[model samples]
Target: MKKILIFFLFFAVLGSGCAQHNAESIYDKDEDRAGTDINRENDGVRRGNGNQDNGMTMTDQNPNLLNTDNQNRHSFSMDVQKAKDVISDAGYEPGSIWINGGEMNVTARLQGLVTRKDREDAQKILQNRLSKALPRYDVKVNIE
Candidate 1:
């Protein structure tokens, strides 16, 4: 019984030591994977500054990062086109459409002679239509 107890204790200590070593190695690997190792100078390899010796940046290494900005611009253009379509459908010539964040500034020209009240009414109607079409944006319409 005593011999068995000693054997079990030895194995327990060995297992604990191995577990600790594995945990430390895992932590080190995680730091390296983050690309910002403080010990980069020791290995003579600088990382995580977006530039590498091969003239490639972090964005270049991951093309998805560039795609994110492109996707945003593409979606914004599509939204602008939709606004233009809405303005045309409302019997106004679509002018400039500016989008800043969640706010949209739209300008449309009214054909034929009109009164101030007519312009105001057209602006309101176009604003309502645009707001309904692009609920994600705060719409402001100018009828000229």
Candidate 2:
């Protein structure tokens, strides 16, 4: 009876430790999986800054769809195309105009150097123009 009790207790302790280890391993795996997601989210911001931090950037991770060359390749909504035309009519060389998820993104070359306030004014003007045209669409402008 004593031997049996000791054996059962030994197994109970061993089994508890194993269970603890199993739980830890599962938690580690979840963390590891989420680790990539966290890094990817940060990467989006870092990369969007045009890799200004001097970090190595991967072109494939983020494509340069803001180029004027590919504008015809992708099918755009009527509002996006209309905004592009408006930008062109405004005498600005538009880079790319894309609309997705009720948002519009515009990249264009504006007058004045990068240091001037005109760049920001240009962005705002373009943003407001699109906003007036597509009231419900979120507009974002980028200068090249």
Candidate 3:
């Protein structure tokens, strides 16, 4: 009998708590008292209305963000040509040159059989020359 009474009391309290949450009834009184016009258009943000000069132009943004694919391709090709010239001037046959962002990878082929020290010296010389020529790029030289 005691357990049945406790169970009935718990359910009664829970049911009252759940029934007290009427969202519409709580918000309706505030909405009625505020009395603000719901149909008004401009609410403080500057949206362009055909003739108003807001003074904010798209050209004010960063130039790097506005760079097109054509500009990037031209820049990359120029860098590759520069790398090829540097490799050729260093007395090696330029095989392939690749430029990615600020890094350049260059491959050059030596004509005859060369010793390991000769290859190492050649790589060092090409690396130094490329670094000096293209100071903006981190260069890697491969001799084959």
Top-lDDT structure, candidate number: 1
Pitting candidate 1 against candidate 3, the one with the higher TM-score is 1
* lDDT tens per residue, model 3, 1-144: 999999999999999998878545634442244664333435844343454545533333432344344333335667788888988888899988987677899999998999999999999999999999889989999999
User: In lDDT terms, how accurate is model 3?
Assistant: 0.77
Alpha-carbon RMSD to native, per candidate:
12.1, 17.3, 9.2
Cα-lDDT of candidate 2: 0.69
Tens-digit per-residue lDDT, 1-144, candidate 2? 999999999999999988875565543442355465332355464222254646523432344433344334333456777887878877788888776766788898966666657777877788788788777778888977
TM-scores for all candidates: the values are 0.53, 0.43, 0.51
Off by over 4 Å in 3: 1-74
The candidate 3 region of ten consecutive residues with least summed lDDT is 56-65
lDDT of each: 0.82, 0.69, 0.77
Question: Model 2 has how many clashing residue pairs?
Answer: 0
10 residues in a row with least lDDT, candidate 2? 65-74
Candidate 3 — which pairs collide? none
Q: Candidates ranked by TM-score, best first?
A: 1, 3, 2
